[model samples]
Target: MSDDEVLLSHDDGRGVRTLTLNRPHRKNALDDALWRALRDALAAAGEDREVRALVITGAGGAFCSGADISGGPRAEHPTYRMRMLSDVALTLHELPVPTVAKVTGVAVGAGWNLALGCDLVVATPSARFSQIFTRRGLSLDLGGSWLLPRLVGLQQAKRLALLAETLDAEQARTLNLVTWVVPESEVDAFTDGVCDRLVGGPPVALAQSKALLNEGVDRTLRDALANEARAQGVNFATRDATEAFAAFAQRRDPHFTGTWAVPPSLTDMNGSARSPGPGHEERLRQAD
Candidate 1:
């Protein structure tokens, strides 16, 4: 398949972008080309200021089935090929914008880990998941070793990895692998609503909050608090914080543009805009 055919991207015009793994005949399996395409698409979304939320799903009623091992052998070294998967995994995990995985059918092996890498995962009742590397005579790849243990505790992670247990939607949710399990009919609408809420949120603040949670797990309390303080300072420098305060006072929803607010120097000690001299008003125009 062509690169674009292997991975489809659509923007909803309301700041939500959806990426579909398009190789459904192979259960959306990632061939080497698809891995590259997925990585590039995720990187593009991260760089796009207009994309406030992202949803990763699969076409033809199935989520990914992991790597396309059925393909003919290649000349590349195993480590080099593994690097491609690593790049895709890290790019998805480090995205500043919120991400959701909409799972309809099976998500196994690296496919399951891909879903887990998202900030949130929504699955239909019939969806299935497995850490199937052992069944395939392989070990966990695509951040599964790190994500699974943290998500489900070491004991549960070991059970899943060693046994290659297939989990239904409810079972996965109980283990904290899936965030929500909606009915098959409602999963699309439910995921859309969730993404809509994320899209409407303050982008700068949300990004900071996501970063803090991702990093806080590995930091001391004192370090985490210090990092939070720094994040709050950054948030306050954005127009969204001021808009949020104003909206709260007015009892209305805040509109966030993620623009930089007036700098401290451009604002007086009283927190009002300061015109240092003639024509300074234009200089104080909000920075993008």
Candidate 2:
């Protein structure tokens, strides 16, 4: 496939962008070029105000098998190569839009971490996951070390990483790793439904809530409450907030436009509406 085909992007005209990893031959493994492509796609999605939701999935039944070790020798230094992965990971994690990972077959090594980076994960009954790093004679990369512990607790994280144990979809759900275990036939429809709800929600409020939850983990209760106050203050200044209150009173569904209704003078002490924004890895010898 040509470079453009490494990662395929689709916009459904409903504010949902689906990014499919298109390399079926290698289970959509990340080679340098594919990594770059994924990173760029995610970056573009983040910047596009029209994109309210993002979905990541793999073509050909498998999510990904981590890095493409079979790819030929690399001219770049290992650190430099790792920087590419780091960029992709950070971009995905920090993306303002909600993201979903639709997993079918195996998501191992960095591939699993990639899915974990998303806000939600939907996997089929037959889907499988593994840290797969130790088995490859390496340690976790692509934010696995950080994501796993927070997701499944430190002990479970260590077990997965140290043993490189593969877990089926149900088992992963039990560990709180997979958000939803769906049947293959219905998975697509189900995921589309989820995205629709997300897309229909108040965008500014959802973004604010996502940021609050993400930051709440590391913050003190007092600090979290403070942040929540600020977030709600901003939310109330959006047209969406008005629509929601009106909808509630009218007993109808609210149509959120995500438009900022705050006057330029109110959004900032200096009378500027601008607000400060809130703030991956490589293959083995290639490593994931």
lDDT of 1 at 10: 58
lDDT of 1 by residue, 1-288 (tens): 375644545565778888999988999998877888898899999999989999999999999999999966787779998998999998998899999999999999999999999999999987999999998899999999999989999999999999999999999999999999999999989998998899899999999999999888789999999999999999987889878888999999989888887656767788888666775557555442
Query: Whose TM-score is greatest here?
Result: 1
Can you give the lDDT of residue 230 in candidate 1?
A: 100
Task: Report lDDT per candidate.
Answer: 0.90, 0.88
Q: Candidate 2: misplaced stretches above 4 Å? A: 72-75, 263-288
Query: Which has the greatest lDDT?
Result: 1
For every model in order, what is the number of clashing pairs? 0, 7
> What is the TM-score (0 to 1) of candidate 1?
0.90
Instruction: Give the TM-scores of the predictions, in the order they appear.
Output: 0.90, 0.89
